[model samples]
Target: MLPPFTEETARLKVQLAEDAWNSKDPARVALAYAEDSEWRNRDVFLDGRDEIVGFLTGKWERELGYRLLKELWAYTGDRIAVRFEYEYHDTEGQWFRAYGNENWEFDERGLMRRRYAGINELPITADERRVAV
Candidate 1:
């Protein structure tokens, strides 16, 4: 059986993901994965950090003005699960909230070796998604 995860580890992993997303830097985010990491995001399967970086770069380019928040769902040993919500504006200024869950498995060296993500998008009204100043 896999070992239990400490609360601290779970929190840290979530924080790392959040920071990486906020940075909007694909290269930086890709470094968090192992050299030959495997990933399935939505329906696309990608392997290796280069592909991860390329995918993220294309994603951010198309999904402009992206911002995200992730919450820890569960954890076991070196694997962690999380659910996330994100808001982004498409090329045409239409706003959407994307809800998703991810399963992540890290190797012995704390580098993520595998990731599986499921995502869906929903349209949001301007008032519903507005940020108060």
Candidate 2:
């Protein structure tokens, strides 16, 4: 699962990420990243796996019923770009659909070394929710 990925491998990588995030397991998801991974998630910047785990923990706590879908937009060398959508509801029961894109750089070991993401959210009624989870 090193870099220079083929189409099949790239798709696999995307699917794996989607699954990990959907699991809502911070530690599990963090395992895919390097020890000193760097990330720009929305407006916040994070460094290292510890920060990733903490961020995800808080995120999942705030975003109930989180469900994510990610597609591989492109891949070259050790870089991958993804387009993603996710749905979640806040504690107040207001639902939201988030659309985003992420650029990821991987180390030789296939661990993500850097990630940059931009995201926007739209309010939605419960009836508008598409993902079952």
In model 1, what are the clashing residue pairs, if there are any? none
Cα misplacement distance, residue 49 of candidate 1 (Å): 0.3
Best by TM-score: 2
Model 1 per-residue lDDT tens digits across residues 3-58: 24587877887888898988899999998899999999999999999999999999
How many pairs of residues collide in each model?
A: 0, 0
Q: Write the per-residue lDDT of candidate 2 for residues 21-66, one digit (tens) a residue.
A: 9999999999999999999999999999999999999999999999
Model 2 lDDT, full chain set: 0.96
* Candidate 1 error regions (>4 Å): 1-4, 130-133
Query: Whole-model Cα lDDT per candidate?
Result: 0.87, 0.96
